[model samples]
Target: MSHECTTEDCRNHTSTYLCGRCTSDLQQWLDKVPVLVRELSVTVARLDNVRPAGGGGGGGHQPGSAAPISLDALQLQENLRSVGTDAKAYAQDSRAAGLAWLIQDWVTKAELLVSGPDEPPINHAANRERVRNIAPAMPTRELLPWLRQNARIVVTSMDIRNWARRGKLNPVGREPQPTYHPHEVINAWHDTRVP
Candidate 1:
């Protein structure tokens, strides 16, 4: 089950597309994206404060009349914009590489993440009918709200719904909206997250 590492010029063999070294490198690059965005933001802000380039010159144009923007500053602003808010949340991804990408829209001077991009991808919606068909029971509506309030951050409605669709969760509601028994959701959520 071994194959060549997907990264260019790396000869390591691994079952996954990336070898351990490349994955580590990519993880580090992702970790730096937020810092790079902050620095570029400061650079752009600093550029805005300087006098316009044509200032102090008598070239038939008014001095300090224009915004003080340089090519470097423009590039910096572009870099900042490319970081996209989704990538900013990498700050808490110590658990795994489920998300995180980009080497230069935020990167180190020496290396780039192999799959970095401005926007994070979106998953296709799970089939409602399929999920409904698989849910285990018709739990009371009262439990659904409670589960949502309790596990709002960890396992969202979509997560449970999708899990049920894939047979990971045997949700307990017949509603098209896809409700779950509190106990089932929590147990399943815990199992999926830990190990």
Candidate 2:
């Protein structure tokens, strides 16, 4: 009796237990396993490098104390193990589900490692540049006239002050009168006026 291919997603009938097409697909996935494992190993090594030099005992070593492992690192390690196990299972059974799940989990772990908060701390300079790019900074005194001329809307000083109090407008400098980014003020004005 003819048997169907054992690999998931394969529908070919085969005289043998497994068809050649399914066998090739399984081999391709198995080949990728080692590369993924190597990538995960590199991420773990990078995490190790960033770890604190010693257990936080304030320069004194405590007995039975070791450096604390990051929770992210531990999770990545667990994912690596799961991938390895599933890859083996996929190899034996030629089941696409196991390898697909392993790939998805590996991708998640890699993204966490690459994008963890510690690296490339917030860029204040870039933020300033972005604000400048959005609109030229204008003093509150100049802002009211500019808005009336450019935005075709009349805004009172009290309205600007209220926007500042409400956190809709962020002032750049000293109080009593502060500079503002025109784009932000314009957006806030539009938002408030929306019925």
Candidate 3:
């Protein structure tokens, strides 16, 4: 007897419950399960290697010291725990069991923990003043090319303009094309590119 395949998106008829095409796709998906599991194990090992930002092992203080945990490290630990929980939940789910999203989230959190904000976050005004005092301002046109050549990173003129508009990048001069401090631009590049 011929009947429609049980698999979604499959319209072929089969004597058995699943059509040949659907069975082939299911076999391919099953074959990927081992690879995904191995990748997840590697990710767990990498996360285990993630230590506190400072020279400390667990927290930001010396080993066996009584110093309180830094807020940044604490947040990192929390994020890691959340990732672990999410991974377990994904494993338990029968459908949509891909690990790519979980791995990406873990990587993003790890990056944040490694390159988090400066201690006692600086205010916008103080940051602007510090940038001005450190280096001379350069117009966007000149700065873009210089950054690409020196920093070996491609930061386009439009990126600088958009960052300035969004208040992510600060400018020194307001007339014509806005000028940005060299150090500020470098810092921005490091923040975004370093990982």
Candidate 4:
């Protein structure tokens, strides 16, 4: 969906609430902004607001004194501060939107894990043991490639354990933290050993 305005006139329409035409134009303007520009706009606004306004005007009322900052300058400074705050907020909002997309992707993957048919049945420990006995000897360099090709469908820890129990693949004997070849894990889903 898009709104209607074609020119900068919509910028002013911010306060009035853009009519359908200008709303579309303004949206197009926003869409074209690079993400870096959006982030930088916030940072620049923040820096300008905190800097001092007075400089270069010296005076001694009786012996020595400096003039107070002008009210107009102070007002202008406040306006700049407000703009910076708005930029920071926009940057945060944009980041949140990006994160939302990433989370959605993660959720979809998790859903597939729970709902897909390729997921192994959880109750068959004996079948898992049968698959495990066929696992090949480890410490061999060929293990990684074999597992990748044969066990490509093995998706969970239980799948690996089942393959190992059946003796089709052997996990490396690392003390306290053994790891197995990726392909050996994959071969388990075929209801056979890796050889």
TM-score of each: 0.34, 0.34, 0.31, 0.20
Number of clashing residue pairs, candidate 4: 36
Q: For candidate 4, lDDT tens digit of each residue in 1-195?
A: 333322333433222233444434333433323432333344333433233234443342223433333333344333333322122233234242333333334333333322334756654455445546776455434455555555444255555566667787577776554577543454455446333
> What ranges in model 3 sit over 4 Å off?
48-195
Superposition error at 177 for model 1 (Å): 99
Winner by TM-score between candidate 3 and candidate 2: 2
Clashing pairs in 3: none
lDDT of 3 by residue, 6-75 (tens): 5556678766555666555444444444444434443433444444444355435566654343444454
Question: Which candidate leads the pack in lDDT?
Answer: 2
> Model 3 TM-score?
0.31
On the 0 to 100 scale, the lDDT of residue 87 in model 2 is 38
Over the stretch 110-151, how does candidate 2's per-residue lDDT look in tens digits? Answer: 556655545667554464456457667788889889777766
lDDT head-to-head 1 vs 2, winner: 2
Q: For candidate 2, what is the lDDT?
A: 0.62
